[model samples]
Target chain A: MILCDIGNTYIHFCDTYKIWKNLPDEINKKELSSDVYYISVNSINEKKLLKAHKNSYNIASIVNLDTPYVGLGIDRKAACLGVENGVIIDAGSAITVDVMDAGNHLGGIILPGLAAYTQAYRSISPALEKRINFGMDFDELPLNTQSAISYGAIKSVVLTIKEIVGDKKAYFTGGDGKFLAKFFEKAIYSEMLVFNGMQISIDKALKKHKEQK
Target chain B: MILCDIGNTYIHFCDTYKIWKNLPDEINKKELSSDVYYISVNSINEKKLLKAHKNSYNIASIVNLDTPYVGLGIDRKAACLGVENGVIIDAGSAITVDVMDAGNHLGGIILPGLAAYTQAYRSISPALEKRINFGMDFDELPLNTQSAISYGAIKSVVLTIKEIVGDKKAYFTGGDGKFLAKFFEKAIYSEMLVFNGMQISIDKALKKHKEQK
Candidate 1:
């Protein structure tokens, strides 16, 4: 089976559930001939996916949105899928903590990502450019304006997620997922959550296809 | 008695507890002989205070910063002094929510102001400069990226504050005070909170000065 996950910035195509970034060019050279192809895209950049399959023959296909479920932004959906009853946190360009219970998806909170918050204050106030530090102590009194902004933004998101999730299992994913996982004792990190969800969807689709035949 | 309250942005001097901003220069010039100049500067440009009193010969010597308070931002100190017992929110370039109970003061939360959030995203990604409306509608989604950011940042702060000060009286102040006040159901707006805090400080200082004599 071939799986493709498209995001706001980059596209990932993988044959197996390991790191795709380290894959060799030979993987790209293979003719696309899988029983089922699962594709996910958030941006309008479908051309990248089309180019990859240009040399391949026609095959069964399944497409899905990259959020809230399979093909969804794995950062969010995986958190939702990973925990049957808890909070899913995706801390990347932005920090999103969503709560899911039973089958219903409770709303989540989104804040400026840690680095994004620091970069933001620096850009707007030229005076604060030299003072942006992402990993500084938040509880200590912020020494300058830039530290104040960064520390405040980070703490705001952390505290908000903690408040909503309470004692529930907190699942962390995305770019800074592992980094934020340290803050919460209940947090669990699964790097390929989005990919895993996509794989599950592909398996389900193929099973249904065979059953129909 | 001449009371001068210096804040982070402006200096407000008043003879009584009335509207000082709209007071005529002629009134200040004529009746203010300054037997005792009660001056309070809450992390503001001190030079402006000196310039204002450069020609006031009867200024029995300006006394400042001799209070028992330590390690608090001038704006926060001012806000705490202004409110009786409630959550004092200072919404400016950043938003700080300080809680005061009875005569003692409790610590608060600090985060980026609304404009700072939008400006940060706009600087990093110029494509998000379009104006966007913010509300509780998850179905509509954010058409322009800027609205998505503004909605996220504003909602984060509001929700956090609500969690912090549940069922407590809330008071809003600062540059963006009015804009933020609309988010809370029972929040009271005080445009001159810092100045009022300054007044309280001045009163305490004058009483101390008189007792010392």
Candidate 2:
């Protein structure tokens, strides 16, 4: 069985312990012979894959989790499912901070990612335009404009995450997850968190189908 | 003496206890006989005002403070000058958080203002676009997208300030000063902080001119 997570840019596939990615256009050229379960944010790409492959399932359709948040992204839902009790952080194009306790999604907040933080500063004024130093020391206040903005971006996000997570175990995922996880006293960095979530959802769906039969 | 703070959108004039604003275009139509001390971010408008009035002085020239921060805004310099020790927050197009202690400028960081925060979220994705509810409760994790983004913006900013200002008093100024000051246990909301800084600079400049003679 193969699990997939499709974003606007890339279509990621995970089979067992192996993971690979393909462009949306590349989906039509290759034949997906095995059963593929996928969750996608890109509807157009999802439709194209659905048309090309007969043995494909949109995992988002089957994944069920307890969440009070209305219109929570399927990707976030999948990530939350992988953890029973922890603060799940998905730091991609946007950084999402979700809290889960006793196997239920408590809710979450969204912050601009590192790139988005840089873009936000640049958009405010030309003087504020500076590259964010992700590795800047948060202990001391920055004395220069570049360091100031950089420290602001990194520190603000770190503080927000720390405030929300509290004593709960933190699970970090996505592109910049490892970088942010370094600041925490203890955080689990799992690259396949979303994929693991997809697997869990697929398992639950299959079990439900079997019980129905 | 008349004091003016020129920004991109509006020209704010403070005369003693009275304060008023004028559009950039309206400055030429009005005749000014009084000596105006002004700090401006708008160069064209500053030059135009300079040409129109010979008695006008750019207050940025006279203000002297101890700090290592480079390219700091004149308005921020003036705000810092108003307080002996405190975290000065200027919430306008961009929210600036500066730490001042015992008459020395310790440096500061900048974050996107409330409006900029909204713009940042909207720019991330179409689905993420929502009006930020500024008054949302921060104690609980937000269950809806609107509250989530709003809470994230407010809570992050508040936490950053709280982290930096620890035991020091907080001095809030600018357009959204009063609103943000409510979050802190004890904070001074001074509308004339920048103007006061300008006045202090003018007094110092006059004293130096006397000493030279």
Candidate 3:
């Protein structure tokens, strides 16, 4: 089976051995020869992807989890469902840190990612428009303009996540997940975490469909 | 005598009895019958203010503080000079947290303030465009979008300050300083912190000038 994750910008397609990204308009119907499971945040692209594959399934409807957070994104929900117990950090455009304990989502907070951070600083003053120094020393307070802003942008987010996760095992995913995971002693970085969630939901959906038929 | 703090937007003036602000262009030389001592970040306004008052003294040339942080703002330096031992938080357009111990400046970090934070979220996605909920409970993980973003913006900055401050008294100033001071156990909100620093520097300069004479 093929797996897909549709975002605002691109549609990511994954098979058994390869994963590639294409624009929503570039999706070809003739390419899919098997069942496809997907989760999407973009409605228009989701419909296009659904039309490309006759057996396409949006896993959002199938994935079940306990969460009290209203308006929580499906991507975050899927990541939580991927893990039975742990903290989930999806460091994409926004760094979302969610706490999952024994298959239940406790709650989470949202932080702007690196680009968003840079934009925030630039908006305050043009002099503060420096690239985030990810490699700066976190142990000592920064003593320079670049390092000071860097410490604020990176350390503040890291400290917030650290305080929340505590001793809980943290599961990291998304583009910047690996970089963030390094700050914690018990962090697991998995690129396929969202896909893993989609697969679980697909399994449950197929079983329910079979029983009904 | 009069004290003035010139910023990009306004020129704040303080007398023994009252305080008022005026635009840089609205400054009148004839209105200043007494000596005016000022510190300014806006160079063009600084020149304009200096030309307006013949007896005006820029306090940036007088205050002495031991700091290793290169390119630190003069306003921040003044705030540090105002206190002998404490953490200084100037929460204006940006929240600058500085660590000063026993008359020595350790270092500081900068975070975007409320307006900048709002802009950051809006840039990420319009759905995230919500005013910062400063009243959100810090102890609880947020269960809604607004609270989640609020917790991230406010709590993250507060926690960062908390970890650095530890047992030190925090001296808060700037526009948003009063709101942030509530989160700390030992915080003093002072509106005249920068002016206090300017006073200290002026006294020192006068004593030195008398000794030379």
Candidate 4:
């Protein structure tokens, strides 16, 4: 089975067993299996990928997330399914935190990621361009303008988690997941959460297919 | 004397007495004071403001910001002068928290303001643009995407304050000063902290001018 998840930046592809992240543009469709399930938040990117793999495999029924939450992306919904009851933080272009207790969706918050926060200011004030550098000490207060921005952007996530997550177990997946997970010892790092979730959805669909047959 | 501060989004202008914010593009150069002090983080905006008022005022020796830290904006310097032994939170397009004590500069951190945080994600993912709205309860976990963003953005400031400030005095200034000041009962809300700081600098400059005379 082949599983694919698309975000604002990159397309994540996975097999039922392993994962291939940030897949190249020229896809080698040879590795893909008979079953495929795909979900995306970027429509144009999704269309392009689907067009490339016109007749690749048997596509499974992708889960519908729009009904429950108007514009909740598949990546988030899938990540939620991957976890039972915990605060899931997707630290991608946007750092999103969703809390689920007893499989009931309590709520989620989406704030700026590191790059997004810096770009937010740099886009408006060109003077601040290239002013700040990342990979700083989140504990200490920064002296210069750029360093100040870096500390603020990075620490805001940790600070937000501390405020909202409280006693809930924290799980993370995304590009910056490892770096962010370093801040907290207990945060469960799930590098392939969305893929694990895809497998679950695909298995359920396949079982239903056999019953229908 | 005319005092002007250029932030990421708005230009705050204040005479020794009255103040004007987000001045119109067509600047009324008449009734202008001879002495003007200016500070800016946006170079282009500052250039335009200076160009418009060319030869209109002596541009009073803009308040000199004497600090070891480089790239520290005069606006921040002025605000520092506006307070004593406290943490200054400037909640503008960027939320900046600076610590000052005993007439010495400790350090500061800059985070994304509410708008900046939202814009960070909204700019990249247009789908997220209209999905989230502001004005949500920060204490409670939000069920919707927009409310989560709203709660995260606003509550982040409050959380940052609690983490960093820690028993220190909290002084807030900028557009969202009053709204954020409500988060803490003891937080001092200043409508024109930058302006007040500019006034102090101007006074010191004038005093030095007198001593030189």
Candidate 5:
């Protein structure tokens, strides 16, 4: 089976549960054949999917779940599916938290990412338009404007998350997952958890369809 | 005495305690003379003050308190002075809470105002960019995107203020002060509180300077 998780930045393709960072160039390669291909994407560029499909003839299926096409964020839903009963935090271009109760999903928090929040403030307030890098050792006493903003946003998010989760476990994923993990307790970084969750959702759906027969 | 409070959008002038919605065109008129003129402005042209001074020969004294320009918001300091021992909330372009204990000012909370919060979200997220009119009915469910945004911001501010004040009195001021007054246990809408505060500040400064003799 082949699973493809497409996000805003890059695409991840996995075969037999192992992610292939670099795909082989040649099409019709015998080793690339798989019984099933399940694709979930935020972008509906058919050409990209078709190119990947041509390389594997055993690909008997294809799925597209693009934005506005699929309704909600597929990655968010998938992240929720990956956890049994915990908060799943996705820290990418934006930060979102999806809470899962057993296998059921609950609505979560969505806010601009750290960079986006600071950038938006800078853009709106011409007097405060400046860039500053966020580091692990954020100054307790923020001396500059950028640091003050960065510290406030980061502290607010961290405190908010802590307040919401209480003693519950938290699962961190996405580009800044590892960075945030250090600040949160019971937080484990999982780069492919969202993709894994998508695969699990597809498998469950397929299984339910087969059982109806 | 003439007290003028120049805000982000409006200039409120008062002769004694009676508010004049518009500045008098003929300040030289016999009816317009005042012994003292205290002006507190956030974003008004300096020429208006000069004009006021030129017209009033009885304007024996003049005072102007610079706003948002001095690193801290003028509204904040004014709110601090308006209340003796309570939470002073300024719900205008931005919602700020200044906590005062026994007339001594403590730092406070600063967040986007009701309109600004919704507007910021709408601007950043294309899906939610719509104008919303907020209301007073706390139990009423939000029917649309605008109401939802308004409800969320209002609820957040109310909760934060309640938490901060606990058992103390609460004072509300600003353009949207009336709207927020309904949520607090004891909230009085004082449109000229900031101007009054400026007058008090000036009086205190003068008193202290005289005592140095």
Candidate 6:
């Protein structure tokens, strides 16, 4: 069985969070089992993956349960399916905070990432358009223009996530998962969210295939 | 005595925070005192104000205090003089949090206004870029994508201001001063920060004129 999750920055294939740089030359040469499941934010790679194993390639969206918003991404659907109850935060080009309760999706929010916050500050005020350091040490009282905007934006994201999770367990994923992990009280960083959900899906498909025969 | 402050969005004249839409057709016809004082972000207006009272006018920057960053705005310089100590937050096109202590400008931060924050988010992520609702009811757990980013950005500004103020008094000015004022425990909303500062400078300039005579 093969599992894949495509994001804006990288196409993550399997549980290691390893990026799939290019389509493999041959699907048969991959030497993997026939069953395959995948999800993606970038639609460009969707057709290529499906054509590789047209008969066995299963798009993860059709295997879903309850989703809060209509047309929610399959990647989020898979992430939501990873746990029965908790808050899942996927921090990438965009950050999403979804509250899950016993397989029921209560609600969620999507915010701009750290870079977006800083870029916004620059665009509004031409006087402050110059790029400033975002990696500066965190100071409760910002010492300069760069520190204030950068720290203020970062702290906002942290507080928002904390407010949503409250007493529930929190899960972090995506490119910025590790950075967000350290800030949470009981947050677990996982690369297996999409992959794990795919496992359950492929098993069900296999059972269905046997019954059809 | 005439006091004027030119901002990016509007020009404010008089000892109050009243915005001036245009230069009066005839300054001489107003029949006020000939002593004119002014400062501006737009250089075009600076010349107009200076031309009106070129014979006896005194530009504000000459009457001053210890400014931390060179080329600090006269509006901020006047705000620093409004209080001996504490932080001043001017929330307009750009929200500035300046630290003033014992008549010296320690330092400050410049962040984007509310609109800028939203614009930034839209630029980065096209999928979540659709307009949701920035004015939606506030919730601990956001109900939708729009509410999350908007409320999260707003709350961040509040927390950052609180963090900087600590136990000290926080003075808020600018267009959104009242909105931000509500979020702080010890925050005082004042329209007179810049105007009052200008008053002190004008007074000193007058006293110095007499001394020279």
Q: Pick the candidate with the highest TM-score.
A: 4
| Clashing pairs for predicted structure model 2, backbone only | none
- Model 5 chain A lDDT-worst window of ten: A58-67
| lDDT of each residue in B1-213, candidate 3, tens digit only | 998888655677778656777788989666688989788877888888887777988878887778999988878887788888889998877788899878889999988876678788778776678999877887898898898888888877888888778899999987789998999999999878877887888898899999999
Q: Is candidate 2 or candidate 5 better by lDDT?
A: 2
lDDT tens digits, residue span B44-127, model 6: 555665666564354665648686465566677788887888999988767788888887787777767766666776675556
Model 4 chain A worst lDDT run, 10 consecutive residues: A58-67
lDDT by residue (A1-213, candidate 5, tens digit) is 666555443455667557643222332334346643534433343245556565422111312222212134556766666678888788765566656666655445554455554554444344344553458244333334454345445655565556446688988877677877788878888877767776776777688789999
Q: Which stretches of candidate 3 lie over 4 Å from their true place?
A: A8-13, A20-37, A42-59, B7-12, B17-36, B42-59
TM-score of 5: 0.62
Clashing pairs in 4: B36-B60, B132-B146
- Please give the lDDT score for candidate 3: 0.83
Instruction: DockQ for every model, please.
Output: 0.18, 0.71, 0.67, 0.67, 0.09, 0.39
Q: Looking at model 5, what is the TM-score of chain A?
A: 0.71
Error of 6 at B177 (Å): 2.4
**Candidate 4 lDDT, A60-144, residue by residue in tens:** 2455332244456678888887777888888887888887777766678787776777687686466456544557776667777
Instruction: Please state the error at residue B55 of candidate 5 in Å.
Output: 6.7
Better of 1 and 3 by TM-score: 3
Model 2, C-alpha of A127: deviation from truth (Å): 0.9
lDDT of 6: 0.69
lDDT per residue (tens digit) for residues A126-201 in model 3: 7688999888887798788788888888888889899889999999987789999999999999888777777787
The alpha-carbon deviation from the true structure for residue A41 of candidate 4, after best TM-score superposition, in angstroms, is 1.0
Error of 4 at B155 (Å): 1.9
Candidate 1 off by > 4 Å: A1-4, A9-17, A20-84, A103-109, A127-147, B1-87, B98-109, B118-155, B159-171, B175-188, B197-213
Go through the candidates in order and give the clash count of each. 6, 0, 0, 2, 0, 0
| Cα RMSD, model 4 | 2.8
Given candidate 6, what's the lDDT at residue A172? 94
Q: Can you give the TM-score per candidate against the true fold?
A: 0.60, 0.89, 0.86, 0.90, 0.62, 0.75
Error of 1 at A176 (Å): 1.8
